[model samples]
Target: MRPQYPFRVRHADVWRIALPACIAFITEPLAGLVDMTVIGRLGDASLLGGVVLGALVFNIILSLAYFLRIGTAGLTAQAIGARDPADGLLHAVRALLVGGLIGIGMIVLAVPLLMLSGWLLAPGDGVREALADYFYIRVWGAPFSLINFALLGWFYGRAEATTGMILQFIIHGINIAGSIVLVQGLGLGVEGAALGTVLGQIGASIIGLMLMLGHYGGLGQIVDRVRLGELFQRVALKRMFGLSRDLMIRSIALQATYAYFAAQGSRMGDIELAANAILLNLLFIIGFFMDGIAQAAEQLSGKALGANWQPAFEEAYRLSMIWGLIIAIVMGFGWYFFGPYIISLMTTRAPVQAYAVQFLGLAALCSLTFMPAFVFDGILVGTTQNVVMRNGMIASLVVFVGVAWLAQPLYGNTGLWLALHAWFIARGIIYWWALRRIRSRMFAQ
Candidate 1:
């Protein structure tokens, strides 16, 4: 360790985590942006709709498996903070093993899962058929995708932000470039785009694995270093499961609720659905930027917890909030002022355009309320404050459903978005309340 800001207990530790993450996440959208551009040029509305549905499929499967990363980061942070290399290595091993299992399971269940997704979303004929094509081709990358999640999560937990940044650039970069060439140069259409995405993921996973070989010591050599009995132990598995369990519960609740909002949009009409999707992706510009800082909080707080040093934890939290709020305020204004232009860039539909204006207005309003909750989430995860994270999200889920019922009837699609915005505010409140345990202390005595 060169003893940088985060290492020296310096301020701005959150930036250390967030800056790279934000940059990485920003570039990440390039692939999707390119895909959408290509699909848009296809001159067929069905093709566009199919890509949207395909995205939903990918997000659903990948989102459910997010626990691999969350669990790895939390545990890794603790180990790093405790100054235990063994802890880091073991956490990495566990995440890889779990990721492997998840990937295998998903592959086997692909047919049923895709079928279920189609039935659940109830997409119309054109979109449904297009989505079916995208799903089949893209789902082949399941194993690599899961492993990549583990690699990123493990690195993030260890506060190795640069590694994640490098991998993301390579991964998303390939995805963007590959999609462009396949879809445009080869004229493979939507299928080409999907294949490009899968190839990009596989390539990124291979690189990540190679990095593990020397970037931190090959993840594959674990058995030789430790007894087989140790790897399969009940206690170790239980701890990983425990952390993942809480995160899975939170993710499921939060994700399912978001899906509900999406379904609500669908019910309102395709115009609303299209508008919401554009607005939501635009919002990602802000959310992903903030996610970087939150990722930082997770690493710093987890390590602080392991060190049993309350002061470092406070420093990490304070810095995360500082950066999170700054990004929120600045981005909120940007979204408010220039959002119309951003939305206009995505589609040519006039009705969808009209509705997007209203939807974006609400998105800006919620940005303030949303940023803290997001950053705080990473903090709580790092602190292994799982119970509050889980419970608080569940509480907000209820409010979201309740408000959606009332608002959707009165305000229609805008009301549905408003309901979600409220849920965002509530999400922050819960985590802010939960951090009381270590918030009061400046340092360990």
Candidate 2:
């Protein structure tokens, strides 16, 4: 076997992991497209508006729960690097337990959560009713979705991108197919769409469990006679929860920026709201592509740090940056040339199409501005640098608010896009500076 110490990281090394991760990430936006397409075809802008708003509410909630994925991935990656299968298994177990508890909490708090979101979003009357229906149905799947986060993070930490890719495919495939059946054939409307997603999560969780068991040589092998009490050790629990708390804060700050973006668009008008939703999906597509490279950073950097090899870590970071930038540029050009056609497929509304096209160029531009932040996020998260991540996101949110406050009144939607870009640019700068200052210190013996 080749030695990894001097880590001769190459583009191929990044792409090997990134390609499958990219496909998995792309499935997310594709599922969004399916939701919009099914609802948009119903030919009511209000219905479309409801799905958009309902999605944002979940996005915020899920962002809070996202600690399961990011924290588990970082911790498990380091465990894998150190060749500690037991530690990796334990990390996954802890994450799943915490995720399940959090999911149940969300269900218990569903009513108040919905009411709070409705008041904050302030959509039109027609949209409000539809959003309520979607929320009630979707909340039931919270546990499944949360547990899936843990499963996915564990796979990525193992650098098992293909497994992660397969898991995502199963979830999204079920979502798109079930949604079509329920919404189109059964005429369930937005409720059907919501139920489809819930069903997908439930199905995926079951399959994920079976896969994990089979891979680990069944239940007996998994537990391996370890005392149940060991899983709840105070030091381990504290470390896990501490990491979760920081990642949760970072996720909330990130989600707040997106929620604000959707909220402002809602206030504009239904057509504008619908248009912005389409563009937001496009932005997600771009973001996820870069996230593929970020996954590489997470696995490689975490692995390097786990092995206590600075050279490998540096090479991983360098390779990730190069590939991230390349993918961003490619995506920008792809959107610029083909965005109109894609927008046309999403909706039949002439005004929505025109408005979305008007801002398509700016959305494409985001691919580049957002690249640095994405790459840095993977590296930091993989290295378990949670403090920097939490602080950077909060600071970037402030920059976003300031930019949007000044830009929105002056340029309308254009200004809103600008503010979003400013947020990403700020994140890139802050993460870059922090990493530079701490790099040598982090690798110190």
Candidate 3:
């Protein structure tokens, strides 16, 4: 007779993880909100436009390297599931090293990247100058930012959501305080905003490193267990590289879609671009909240897969989806009712507020679709199924482009948003189909 095992997922466990993660994830966009709010108070649409464009450029660039966070979380969770502390340590170390290297590369290539981005964006002179100032100062934070990504990923993968939350709080708290001081108190303008961001990143990286060392019982112990040679073992390195490469491709496609959205908005004029930025901030809030649930799914599902516990994986998937949908519905209602207030808080510009309010309803409708798309992302990443994720993102990107082509000519900015809505829906549908196939194959064993 076969042995029996208990595999149950409780709502309490999900909430325990999701709540802290929600707090942590939300801090990210809050930082952006703070930046926008401070700059918007400057009462210059060009300044807001410049900051928005510059931030979007960095967002796209950094998102390409997001595999450091995502791949580390998935790998570390699996290692923990297999009860291998050494493997978990090695994954974190490897991710940090790679992230550090990539961050440096970004710094080295910053000049050409800025030039290219400027050429493509082709903003008015006022906006371009502001973008240049912001980008130049902000690029210095790349190494620290990437390092924090690895640290946060490792913590989240270990189900140490509280630590992740604390780290994010530290980063954002310092950022918000510094931005207010530099931009408002000191009159440093866009450059001040960028410098404040750099300071926060540098502080977070240092503190996060100290915390990591302490978590592993100091540097001596970590050094002893994380053998340099072991980190480069042929099989493990192959798997790591494979996962990172695939995820990078997937991230680039995803970022490209957003970059396209921002670019299209820019073409509509500064007021429109600024308005889109404010509305998108609301979307970011929604995404981060739903991502809290996805984070739970990643950890739980990865651990389940590592242990070869199919039932546990199923339960994790089901409960995560349930909670995610619930939160999504609640957020949809909140945004519908409170979106104008939220937009007002981000910017005092009358035109920007009016334009953002026009599309707030569409943005709310899109929130309902984020849960399935994002939760499935967590599930697939946890299982290390990067190939399917990559394919689905690419396929969805194609659909978005096609739909935007047709819709934009007919409906303007509303058409662009409609394309975005379709993209989210398509991603969810594609991932769901992929999930079914993966379930059949994995469970059939």
Candidate 4:
């Protein structure tokens, strides 16, 4: 007889966690899609390009602080797995404090950040002016956005995917409605789009906090349970800081790869940049869809590790990969068939639409490669193996830079897309290798 696997995870169990998270994740890019669609319909490629560049700048900056979400999720999942609700709450509180401080710092430094990004992107006068208008308005939402990130992370870590989904819907739904009104109805253009996003973020932050308080049996109980002295003890602080530091490094590397991609496209011209932005939105949709499965892996694997159940971890890993692969294949086929139609719907500009269609095939292929990389990210984050994660991202980024340098001069934009695919493949391979080396060490304990 064939040897049996250690355990089997039910399809229902995986989907129970994944479906809601997937819905939540898709809403994020859905909001972006709305923004792009509104700006694209304005009959000015420069406006679209400006929004794209401005969004990129915000992503690079805000994503650097994503450790607040990631670190909290990993730590809280493990705590919950251990049946330590108080400890989980402690992790959430600490993460919120850090996120709040970081958000404030971002606001304080917004001017320099905008100036530096403007200098680096160096768009044409029209695009530059639009970019400034968008950035100046949207930067104020940094704190609330970070707070909401922590809230979503905390909810997911607790295996409350439905609640997370509701929160995400609230945020993005308001964003979509507001964008439609401000950009299309009021004709405020890019600045209105930025304001709509900021308003959504701020509103979500408030509602999320209220829900969190209700879940924890009010503010008094939460405060009583979270002993500041113990929570911020030297040892606890070290562990939290260490995890955040490593994740911050990993995030910086990942963001740098995309930032480089966008900067290069900007240099190629406004049409090329706008085309790439459309394609990149498609990539984001794929990434977020895959991230839903990754989120499942994170919770299940972290719980297994905390409970000292090796078989559970193995089962979680197996099922996550299976589902991730299936979804990625479906997405790839869908993109291959319907991508041009989707591009046409976003913009009336024929050149931009045509250029995006030319690259749609490459984007579809990249989606297939994203599966392992994204799932492995969830597993590592769940395990709080930040050092390994950081190292792997750094290695993949080096490969991306090297590949882009060698290929871009020869093949132009196609070469850049090729480099992006290489980056995804490289990340998957490196993380797989690292996981293999660490598996026995992690489980044997």
Q: Residue 114 CA error for candidate 3 (Å)? A: 2.7
Model 3, 1-445: lDDT tens per residue? 2222345678987887899999888888778879988999999988999999988898888888898898999988877776774648998999899889988898899889999999988999999889989998999999999999999889988889998999899888999999999999999989989998999989989998998898888999988887768878999999989998999999989878988898899999999899887778678878988989999999998877766678888899999999988999999999989998988987899999999999989889888876799999999988889999999999999999999999998999999999999999999999999888777565454
Candidate 4 per-residue C-alpha lDDT over 102-173 given as tens digits, one digit per residue, 9 for 90 to 100:
888888998898889989878999998889899888988888889988988898888888988998898899
Poorly placed runs, candidate 1 (over 4 Å) = 1-8, 124-129, 216-221, 269-271, 358-360, 411-414, 437-445
Highest-TM-score candidate: 1
In TM-score terms, candidate 1 sits at 0.90
Q: Total clashing residue pairs per candidate? A: 5, 0, 0, 0
List the RMSD of every prediction in angstroms.
Answer: 3.4, 3.2, 3.0, 4.1
Model 3, global lDDT: 0.88
Q: Per-residue error at 436 for model 1, in Å?
A: 1.1
**Which parts of model 4 have CA positions greater than 4 angstroms off?**
1-8, 36-52, 123-133, 182-191, 263-277, 346-360, 408-414
**Residue-wise C-alpha lDDT for candidate 2, range 1-445, written one tens digit per residue:** 2223435567787888899999998888788779989999999988889998998789778878888998889888888777775748888998898889889998999999999998888999999999999999999999999999999999898888889899999999999999999999999999999999999999889998888888788889988835578788899898898888999899888878988998899888898899999988888878888889999999898888777778888999999998888889999999989999999998899999999999999988999999999999999989999999999999999999999999999999999999999999999999999999998876777
TM-score of every candidate relative to the true structure: 0.90, 0.90, 0.89, 0.89
**Which regions of candidate 2 deviate over 4 angstroms?**
1-8, 39-51, 122-129, 187-189, 263-277, 344-359, 407-414
Task: Please tell me which model should have the higher TM-score, number 1 or number 4.
Answer: 1
